[model samples]
Target: MSFREMTITLDDVLAFLHLPMGGRFYTPGYATRAEAAQTCALLLGGSASDYALKFDHVKTIGLRFGFLQELYTKALRDRRYGPATQMWLVHVVGSMLFACKSGGWYTTVHWISIVEHLDQVLEYAWGAIALPTLYDALGHASQRKTKQMCYYTSLLLAWVFEHFPPTIIQRMEVPDYTEDQPRACRRRESRTGHPELMERQVIFDEMTAEDVIWTPYEEHRDRSSAAVSVDGAYADYEPYLIPEGVPATIEGEVVGNYLDWYTTVSHSVYHPG
Candidate 1:
């Protein structure tokens, strides 16, 4: 059986998830424990020592989602509205969008700095960060002994469900989808009785171009019209589109070589055949 190259693109991310793809790139630099504690105290109104105790470990200055939730609750109870909202944002961004593989709970302290000034939270390129993160996680998960992965996996799942035939997916009906809802919201994957690994591989091996849904969302385009509007709010992501045989370049250097690289790379799964 011949193989076909497939990928999740910025267009898929925008159409399915409706994440913000504009503003300054998200570059959360590393933070030492002292710096993390200081930021936590200033933003969440806690003592430095108390904040220090929330770190995930001695070497990594990271905080758990549980700790962030506690701080969020405390800020709300104390009527510190600003801190509460910041804490909530941190928790959501960390746990939902940029989660790490550390037991699926810890997030680096560097994210706290992003929310340091509330006015600038919306300025970061969250979708840009999320897509790369998902790509990284996928690469890692493809490696041997890699037992787990974290990040916005919903994007990958949604892209697959949208592009592939429904025979491979167990989707539930979404009755009340609206213009404001993300395309992902219209389909739900059933939880029970999924196919085993080899069964899934057989199904994939049997797939042909005719089985693919090139434009599965065409019927829903009218409902999703508002969700896909860029309208000066998002960054110009169109220039990065990866059309067939076209190279993506930066400073006149081709970066789309990854397409070739991925085709040749060995992608062994964690389990033995």
Candidate 2:
């Protein structure tokens, strides 16, 4: 069997999700239970004890999505619009953008710290963090005995539906495209049913270069003529661009050893050419 390299580029994230590709890099730091509880109380105006209880696990000093939702609802009832909105954004970032592997409902308090100052929230390089988090989830899911996966799965699914043939996906009717909406909003997964595991394996085994849609966004590209600019504060993510040939690697013994190990286990399933 031949092999083909399939990658989801930074461009795909920018175009498909319209998430900011440039901003201050978000690096999560360690926070103790006291610190996390303080953050929740100061920003979200809740009892420190109640917030402390949410940190059931020491490793994941985070709150549940259900807890956040309850806070949001309570805030709305009390007419505390500002805190309510902040709670909502916190829930979105934690549950959707930077979800933890613990489950879909649990999210770390790190996002609460980030969302504390709403005015500066846009200054975060969300796309940078999100892509890598998804990659991490995919890596974990690929391991033996890993039954479930988390993180922003919608991005991965959208990438697959856009690049793969409909025969393999059995996609539903797509919605009309609009410049205001992200590309991901238009596509939906099959609602009828899915093929069995063996059937899917056969479909993948038979996949060829002709079966893949190399450039599904050609029309959208033409329509989006206006160029978007990146701020100078953010790292120029030019390295994410597809290279001409075998990509350059960082010169280091560790990297070299990893590359050797990866090459032995990794096998391509399709050849584009």
Candidate 3:
């Protein structure tokens, strides 16, 4: 919070933009620290809940109790909309309700402007978090990966804000939901017997572990430090494979045998090409 620390953080962010690789905190698309802080402030303002909750509260409860269910099902089925886009839409729709709950902003202008601003911020924030890594894995990934990330990250942001007014979620009394199984309840759609469920949710400490599961990382994940294989051949050497460079490849019959085995058993055939 100090001036010097703030300056240092800004410098760090600028430095991060300089890096060519993905997954660094300093990446380009993110809101600046100041912008992020402003968003947090506006979102957390006293009036935010009032403005956002009005529409959401009734719809959420209806969806929870099996009243109008087909809502989320169609949303889910839509190939064009991902989670993040859907969440921003929900926020925009529920703005007035949230404003009523928040009861902080004096003027309507503040509410409307903030909603538009937050929508833009949310869009950028979701991309900023995941794109670089996606690009790094392969020179480029399909739109599917982008959608996957957007959907999950938007859900993440929604869960974060749902608890903004503490009272709204507490009074709603719905079961906890996570990305895997997002709806704790449903609303039956009038035309189709389908039920619309809540896509984004907040979990409390009282919620059991069975209610949620955290996502696994996209890259190599070592669950434990326990040794998998020992290098007996290199035990005598302090540093093996020093000054990394290409090593000679096995040739002739060995190469032919390896190639045959690779072609026969490789999973790449079924993988994305």
Candidate 4:
């Protein structure tokens, strides 16, 4: 099918859910084919959904479910359509626990399945974007590289469903740059490593530029490694947790400041190697 046809179908799905065809953060409102494509891409890829979920004002989880349901419908027609959708759904659900006035209560009672569904959604996302688009999304050195967080998040989301052993995850540590090896150098190691480098794995948390392309989605060492029972296991798999009692409203600012601090401190403390 042509790009126009595909986009039309995507828009129909978004409309079914009544989701606005619009920009996020920098851009707003669907204005052109390119803008619409971007909005669709963000929703399918999950950037749009994430921004909505971030706001405490987005009280109802149904809005999210409607979005996911639409994505699932799209996935059925073209698995790539849904699968390549953003991998941020988990974050979206998790944000609800914080975003909602009721805290985890509403999530536990109503939206649990959405949390559980992340594995399947993640598999599709990995299958879709884990290639050239993801690569192309990376800007050259002159331009700042796209934030590695989303790429790494996608990898981790896919891995969660893969039933990877806790040992593997624990061992799958991202290199800590502050110590002997900086994160950047470890990223270099991932890039330079010889034949069949994707097999040479690193911890999900240790992800860096060189390691962005490879994910555990395709190959699993052991099927039994999958964590079937959610319970606490899911918590272990998540990279970040909003500390209880930390106002979610302050989170954005705190996170921005923290990132700024981390960058400023990392640079000042250690000369780049």
Top-TM-score structure, candidate number: 1
Global Cα RMSD, each model: 5.2, 5.7, 22.8, 21.9
Ranking the candidates on TM-score from highest down gives 1, 2, 4, 3
Whichever of 1 and 2 has more TM-score, that candidate is: 1
What are the per-residue Cα lDDT tens digits for candidate 1 across 1-273?
124456887666767766677778866667777887888788778787877876645236667777788888888889989989988988888776666656547776676678878898888877667788788779888777888876777778888788876667677768897646778887788786577777776777777777877766555656665355443453465567555575544322454555456546643223326
Taking all chains together, each candidate's TM-score versus the true structure is 0.77, 0.77, 0.16, 0.20
- Compose the digit string of candidate 4's lDDT tens values, residues 22-79: 2221111324433433343444555544534522333443233344456566666666
Poorest lDDT segment (10 consecutive residues) of candidate 2: 226-235
Q: What is the lDDT of candidate 2?
A: 0.73
Better TM-score candidate (1, 3): 1
| Model 1 TM-score, all chains together | 0.77
Q: Model 3, range 91-203, lDDT digits (tens) per residue?
A: 43333122121222211122223333443543332223333333332232234444222112222233322322332132233345222222212111123332222211212
lDDT of each: 0.71, 0.73, 0.29, 0.32
